[model samples]
Each structure stands twice: as structure tokens, then as C-alpha cells.
Target: MNTQNAEMDVESLQKRRRGCFLDAFLVGSVMFLFAAVTTLAVVGVMTVKDVESRLKPPSWTSESGPLKLTDVSSSAVFTNFAYLEATTSGLKNATMQWAVQQTSVGHNFQYDRTNHWMMPVQSGNYFMYVNLNFTCTHICPSGDFTIHVGEGVVDKLSCKVHLPKLQDSTAVIKKCWTVSSVASKQKLISHMTVPKEGLDNWSLDMGLGMFLVD
Candidate 1:
């Protein structure tokens, strides 16, 4: 009877040990699965956030496009000159046009409606000239206008001019001036330096009488 009792006790103990071992294995597997799932979720969230940040503008920095320029015409008396510098990771050909703007004064110069000759194909500095006639009704103003570069408007000055004026006496006054007029016929040029990051192509579109696009 004693031996039988001892045998029964041993069997019970063995069964309990097996049950404990099985429970432990299940718990470990569940913990490992939970950890793996949590890690994957974290990684996924991070990737999504990174992509959203990249697409958001006014991007502190990134790539973008579809540049437009409008009716840019030159006058005989006051010529409008502009300089644009654009840099991009990816750039193709830039298209530009000159449009007509009805000014306070009547259009004195003949309007030549054609594609301006200064479109840039590659990455470098390009210069353009527009001859304008200035009607002395308003004082002739000349200076640099900021050219917007990139999808975001990054403004850089266009041209610098020294104007001669009549002072108090016979001596003519030579002064340096800057003007932001879209109506004058002036020389416009752009120097594009490629950016370090983002896409591969860069383009700049400067509408003579209007604003520039990049």
C-alpha cells in the first residue's frame, strides 16, 4: 500500500511539472509575438511620418515644379531687365514668354509677342536683354528684382543699374538705384547652381512684364 501511494504521488508531481513547462512555453511565445508586432508598428509609423514631412511645403527644403511666365513686353524708353538663378536636383528646359500689361500710360513701344531668347537648357548662368522705351511721365527707375528659385520662392536680385540724373547744376548726377517694376524693358539673367539634395532636374521661367517662376 505504501509503495502504491508513493508511485501515485510521483506521477502527480510529474504531471504538474509538465503542466508548468507547457504554460511557460505558451507565455514566452505570446510575449515574443507581442514584441515583434510592436516593433513593426513603430517602424511603420516612422516611415509614414518621414514621407509626409518630405511632401509638405513650404518645404524648409525639397524639390518641386510647373513654372509659368506671362506676357513680358519691352518699351522703348524704359527697358525691363531680369536675372533668375535656379538650382534643382532634376531640371529640364524652361519656357518663358512676354505679355502685355495695360499701364497707366499708353503702350508707346511696339509689342513683339514671341518666346524670349533666354531659355536655359542645362545647368549654368544665362543672360537675356529686352530693349524698352521709357516715357518720362514717371521717373525711370532701375535696379535688381529678386528671382524666385525652386518650387518655393527663393528670391535673388536680378540686375544693378547706375542712373545719370541732372543735379542742381550742369554736372550730371550718377546714382545707384534698384527698382521692382514688371513693366520696364531690361536685361534679365539667371545663374543656376544645382542643389545638393532631392530630384535631378532644374528649370526657371521668367515672364518679362510679370513675376518669375521656378
Candidate 2:
């Protein structure tokens, strides 16, 4: 019986030794995996930083430390433009004359008061616009009036309005266009044609504007 007990004790000791070795192997594998993941994470972060540094603009820094980006001038914000309003002086020939108001023009666009035309100095794409305001003083007949903006006898942008035969009627018309590759010194004028009845009853209202847009 004593020999049997000694054999059982030896078997138990062997089992404990095997369990201890398995636990030590599992701990080592976990430690190795954690170390590999940490190294890869650090390497990926360093690579991203290196790529960012390469992508930065050369203007971002100078010999005198980092440069302020606000000091650079941007041409996109400035635009040359002009605005003109219809004057009440020239109404006998049914042709409209435009003039720059003291508060209307912007960036010093070229204008010829004698010819009453807008002339662009720089040849490029330009936007043209016009607004025609008309109001009836007394009873009026049903008719349509056309407003034109262009060189002499050539219409570029135009708008038309139909007025019903009614007393104290009002009509507002607006037109705009983007002219591609406009030449320098090209003249543009705004004019209208109204019948005798329209001239007697319906007159052009204030705020009628013809302008050169950027």
C-alpha cells in the first residue's frame, strides 16, 4: 500500500510541472505580441508625420522662423467695376444716357460722359447688367417697351415689359449677361424705345441703372 501511495504522488508532481510550463509559454507569447504591436504603431505615426512635413508649402516657413500667411496679398479679392444710372436730361430721342453717380462707381471703371458709354480697359470676360423702372402717370394703353444695352445700334443685353392700360401702373425690368472675351475700349450703352402714348403716360422711374460687372 505504501508503494502505491508513492507512485500517485509522483504522477501529481509531473502534472503540476507541465501546467507551470504551459502558463509561462502563454505569458511570453502575449508579451511578444504586445511589443510587436507597439513598435508598429510607433512606426506608423512617425511615417504620417514625415509625409505631413513633406506636404507643407515652402512659403509656410522662411529663414526667419515661420512666416505669417496673412502678410501675402491676394488679387482675387479686388475687382474693377462700374455702375451708372439713367439721367432724365436725354429723353427726346427715346435714347437713354448713363452717368456714374458719386456713390455708384467702384474701382475706377472707365466711362465716357460725352458718349454715355461704359468702356472696359482690360480685355477679359465681363458681366453686364441693367435695370429699367417705369411708372404710368395717368391712363395708359396696353403696350410693350424694350430696353437694350450694347454698342450703338447693337444690342447685347435687353429686357422687355408689357404694360396694361391702367392708371398709375408700374413695371420693373432687369437683365444681365456674361460676355466672354470682351475687348478693351469696347463701348456699351443702354437705351429704350417707347411710343408717343408711352412717353406721355409712362416715364422712366428712378433707380434705373446700367452697370458693368466684373
Candidate 3:
């Protein structure tokens, strides 16, 4: 009887040890699984945040690039432009000396109201334009009218107008050109030539200017 009791006690003790070992293993596995899941979630969150940050648009600043104005002010408007105006009464020797209607000195651009020239103080690109309007008081014959831009020695741009019939009417001629890498202190003067005689019979009104493009 004593031996049987001792054997039973030993069996119970072995079963308890087995149960403890299994419980310890299950707890350890659960803890390891939790740690692994937490690590994966943290990594995924960090990766998503990184991608979001990368996909976001870059902020613009004055140091980054040119300013973008929703409503541009007058001062922000083109400060490097000149617009000269003239009439036939002011034309001399077929060269029109225009008065400065609107002009601002910026981007190294200037106009000589005295010499009738658009002068640039820097060597760069410019947008030059001219507008000529002609009207005949009595009659205009079929002929060509030409506009030359530059000093009398050389021409930068030449524009021509043709009248197909003799009529007492008006004609408007406009031309624009882009000049690249103009020299500093370069002069641009304008001259008009009418194909017919009798300058007194025709009237001419003109506008011209040069604006720095870059």
C-alpha cells in the first residue's frame, strides 16, 4: 500500500511539472508574437509617414524661386519698359522723335527723348515694338511705306506698309521683334519712309518702345 501511494504521488508531481512547462512555453510564445506584431506595426507606420512626407508638395519661398503674386501691384508691374508717342507734326527728316508717354528705368533700359532712341544699359534680350498709323488728307497713291529701326547707319528691324490703291483713308502698321544679346548702351532709332511725295498730304502717328525681356 505504501509503495502504491508513493507511485501515485510521483505521477501527480510529473503531471504538474508538465503542465507548468506547457504554460510557460505558451506565455513566452504569446509575448514573442506580441513583440513581433508591434515591431511590424511600428515599421509600417514609419514607412507610410516617410512616403507621405516625400509625396507632399514643396513649399515656395523667395529664396526658392521667383515670387508668384495673385494680384500684382503697380510697382510689381513691368518696371523695364518705355512707350514713345509721336505725330506727323513732330516728324523730322522722315525720322520720328517721339515723346516719352510712359517709361520707367529698370532692367538696364533707357530712352533718350532728346535723340529719339531706346537705349539699353546692359547687354541682354529685349522686346522691341513699333506702331505706325497713316492717314491721307487729300489722296494717297498705291505705294509702299517703310519703317527702319536703328541708327541711320544700320537697321535692326525694317517694316514696310503697302497701299494698294489711291484713297483718302487710314492704315495702321504694327511690328514687334525680339533682339538677343544687344550690346550695352545700344541705340535704337526709328525712321519712316513714305513712297509718295507731298508729306503735307499725309498724316502719321507713331508709337515705339523697347522693354527688357530678361
Q: After superposition, how far is residue 5 of candidate 2 from its true place, in Å?
A: 63
- Residues forming the 10-long window of minimal summed lDDT in candidate 1: 168-177
User: Compared with the true structure, what per-residue lDDT tens digits does model 1 show for residues 77-167?
Assistant: 2222232221221222242233333221112223333433232222232222212211222222222222222122322233222222322
Q: What is the lDDT of residue 99 in candidate 1?
A: 39
Clashes of each: 36, 0, 0
Q: Please, what are the lDDT tens digits per residue for candidate 2 over residues 122-183? A: 76666555545566667656677777767777776676767667676555444434354456
> Which sequence of candidate numbers ranks them by lDDT, best first?
3, 2, 1
Question: Scored by Cα lDDT, where does model 2 land?
Answer: 0.58
Name model 3 segments beyond 4 Å from true. 1-76, 89-93, 102-107, 196-200
Cα misplacement distance, residue 10 of candidate 3 (Å): 86
**Superposed Cα deviation of residue 12, candidate 1 (Å):** 1.2
Score candidate 1 by lDDT.
0.33
Write down the worst ten-residue block by lDDT for model 3.
67-76
**lDDT tens digits, residues 1-214, model 3?**
9999999999999999999999999999999999999999999999989855432322324565543322111343445555556744422247777664232334455766677777777766766666666676566555666778876578776777765554566654445454655678888788877644534455666666566678
Q: Write out the backbone clash pairs for model 2.
A: none
